[model samples]
Target: MRLSVLDRSRVRAGSGHPEALRDTVAFARQAEQLGYHRFWVSEHHGVPGVAGSAPTVLAAAVAAATSRIRVGTGGVMLPNHQPLVVAEQFGVLESLFPGRIDMGLGRSVGFIEAVRKALGHDQEDAADFGRGLAELLGYFTGDRAVRGYPADGLRVPPFVLATGAGARVAAAHGVPLVIGSFRGEDAMIDAITAYRAGFRPSTWAEEPYVVISSTVAVADTAEDAWRLLVPEAWAMAHSRTRGDFPPLSAPDDVLAQPMTSRERGLFEQSLRGHVHGTPSEVAKALDHLVHRTAADEVLVTTSTYDRAAMLDSYRLLAGLYL
Candidate 1:
């Protein structure tokens, strides 16, 4: 299976945004050297633990830093952006990076009400996500009234970030679908099956393409890999209970703290959903995931408090998967 990298630009508890972003760019270079297919960054608004608020801007930096790997947003939230603006921003990136840029779009709105208002979007705007996607795609095809400048003729392969109804939308557009593996194997199989069955031919794609993103970590032993996932698991549990996604903490500190029954349950559930183990173990799980979902590519999204360990994890996975 083809392997890709998805760096969320996660900030550790003690580190700042600048360091997080620098790590993202550096990680992109490392991923390229490791023979990964593509390196994508994400977009998150008003999240303290995430430094990737503007994926296009970060993608520009990544493209400038790397010469081989394709760089783009893991996605740009469509509900939070104007279609023309997104088209133009990615158009500019495509102008520079040419065939090496992706335009991954999503249907999500801001995580909070205030953040939605800041972006001048409401919950109702999410209903227009399909329309926004159509508009953005139109710009590239020269069908829209307003041109996307350099993007009019350029082929910026658009991929939808699939979740729930997103699979249907992707099928309708005939674009590639990018889904997360945290939703369980059964759900993933159903979504990909439905997408392929309903796909319609378009200039962008003639067949179904699925990219599965999974939280993965690899180490010398199964126990060590699980230890590396603690910080992110704890952060997810904290977010569910506290309504905020805090920066990752040291695994030792996380394991030392006492948790409420609810937090403990959430933490364990989060841990269960991820793929973490020794290289052979991770490879087995990933191979199963690929066969089950018929995935065209697998993107690994792993974050830990220790940068060296995190890099090592990627290297280990690349050695096996790539």
Candidate 2:
């Protein structure tokens, strides 16, 4: 099984964006050493906990810092920028990194209305994602009326960040699909099936390829692994209630906080499908998940309050299959 990373460059409670970004670069190097196939950075605009607003920039840093490991976005939200500009930026990255760059694009609007306005985007912009993606691809393949300059001759492997409509867009374009299903297993299977059924044979890919991204953590004990997930889960719950995604707190701190019934419900919802346990247990669940989803690769998107423990979890998970 091919294991990859999708790092959000998460800012912990006490750490700032600089520390989180530095950790992203350092973690990419470690991931390469640990035999991860690809390292992807995600883009989240106006989020306090996430520092990866500009994934292409972060991808460039990661690519410069590490060799051999494929570096790219997990992805760049396409509606946030013009297609030509997106093409040019990735074109430059591909020129710098050559065969090691992946252009993963998504169709998400900003997290909130203010953020959407700041990006000069709205829900209507998301409606034009397919058209934007087509334009982006045309620039790469040199098939459009407009040119992408340095990117014209480049062959950056494009993958769509799979959401509901995004999966179909990937199928229509014959690019790979990267879906995050940390909520349910059945949903992942349905997405893959839909992609395969609608996939067209384009030069980009002859057949459908799927990459599943999920929260995975491994520790010496099952209980300990669950402990490592608490911070992030609590953060998710907090986001639902407060309309802001806060930086992760310590697991003990999260656990000690009093919760209302609604908060408790949301917290439990966040915990679903988070594959955390001992190595053997996590391995078994991941195997089942990969098989069920027919995933060509699995992207581990694990974030925890404990940075050292996060590294250990990746190391152990890598040992299990890498």
Q: Tell me the number of clashing residue pairs for each predicted model.
A: 0, 0
Tens-digit lDDT string for candidate 2 (1-322): 9999999999899889999999999999999999999999999999888899899999999999999999999899999999999999999999988999999899998999999999999999998999999999999899988889889989999999876788889999999999987647777678788899999989899999999988998999998999998988998998889988888899999889999999999998888778889999999999988778778999898899898999999999999999
User: In candidate 1, which residue ranges exceed 4 Å CA deviation?
Assistant: none
How many clashes would you count in candidate 1? 0
Query: Each model's TM-score?
Result: 0.98, 0.98
| Model 2 per-residue lDDT at 88 | 96
Full-model lDDT, candidate 1: 0.91
Residues 153-260, candidate 1, lDDT per residue (tens digit)? 879999999776889899999999999988888888888889989998899998999999999999999988999999999999998899888899999999899999
**lDDT at 242, model 2:** 91
- Locate the minimum summed-lDDT window of 10 residues in model 1: 145-154
